[model samples]
Target: MIEIKNLSKIYKDEFLYRNFNCAFEENKVNVILGSSGSGKTTLFRMMLGLEKYEAGQILGFNHKKIAVVFQEDRLVEWMNVYDNVAFVLKSSVEKQEMDKLINKALELVELIDYVNYSVKDLSGGMQRRVVLARAIVCRDSILFMDEPFKGLDDELRLRIITRLKVHWRENRTTVFLITHSQQEGMLLGDIIYKLAEKPVKFYKI
Candidate 1:
């Protein structure tokens, strides 16, 4: 589990969180729902140790590998689907092992057929799937997704959601997802947190 105790953050004299406390359960899909600029992303960054807080303690995250899919695809335009996923692991794993991991991830996302296709040529939905594949292939202890389903239509979003549910069931990795959609929260979250101005509220689904 991850715990946030007495958390406080400020930016340009605007307070994001103050004395906020929350806990994300282990091996579950935890969703944080908030509007844009409501400090959902900031909280995620704090938990990932990418941002510093004024005063707080985030426990159970140190030394744990993390996988992330930001709002942007962040894929290398020149790289094909397979290479983009492989790029994340190429520096650490051998060729054969890298190939296996990449293949497995693509297969899980149902994009194995497009493994050689350039990301620039793929549709928006396909690119999103590639991004998800890359994150899942890392095999990290925790996964973070920031508005991952943005820009896609409802049909595609639902398809990707189905894939994610299966992936979580198989891997059982701790997941933290930030989004603004209530439908998405109901679909993907095991525990849903609603963030507002100062205090944050949450409920189990």
Candidate 2:
């Protein structure tokens, strides 16, 4: 389990979190539902060490590898889908093994056909899938997803979510997903928490 204890964050003289506490179950899909301006993304950034808090301790991730799929599709526009996904992998990984991993991840996102296509030429939704594939191939200890399904249509989103569920089940990767959609929270979350208002706190559902 991962615990956030006595977390406090103040941004521009306003408090985002004050003594906020929460625990996330290991190998589970931990969903955080929060509306705009509720600081959910900030919380993720803090936990990922991209943002700093005034005081707190995030336990159980000391030496673990982490992967993130931000709201933006942060892909290399000049690179093809396969190369973009391969960028995060270590050089020591065998070429055949790396190719296998990339292919499986692309298949999960239903982007196997676009392997050689440049991300700059793909649609927004397709690019997002490329980003997802990159994260999936990492096989990281923890995965942070902040509205990862933004560009995809409802049907595609649902399909990818189902595939992701199977992937997570097989990999046993701890996941923290931040979204405001109730349907998304219900469908994907193994442990759900509602978060809103100032001085952040989470209410488990």
lDDT of 2: 0.90
> lDDT of each model, Cα atoms only?
0.85, 0.90
Q: Report how far residue 11 has shifted in candidate 1, in Å.
A: 2.6
Instruction: State the displacement of the C-alpha of residue 42, model 2, in Å, after optimal TM-score superposition.
Output: 0.6
lDDT tens string, model 1, 166-190? 8786888899999999899989888
Kindly report which residue pairs in candidate 1 clash with one another: none
lDDT of 2 by residue, 1-205 (tens): 7999999999879888999888889999999998988898998898888988899898988989888999988787889999999998966478999999999999999999999999999998899899889989987889999998888899989999998888888889899999989888998899999996787778999
After the best TM-score superposition of candidate 1, give how far the Cα of residue 157 lies from its true spot, in angstroms.
1.4
Model 1 earns a TM-score of: 0.89
Model 2 vs truth, CA RMSD: 1.2
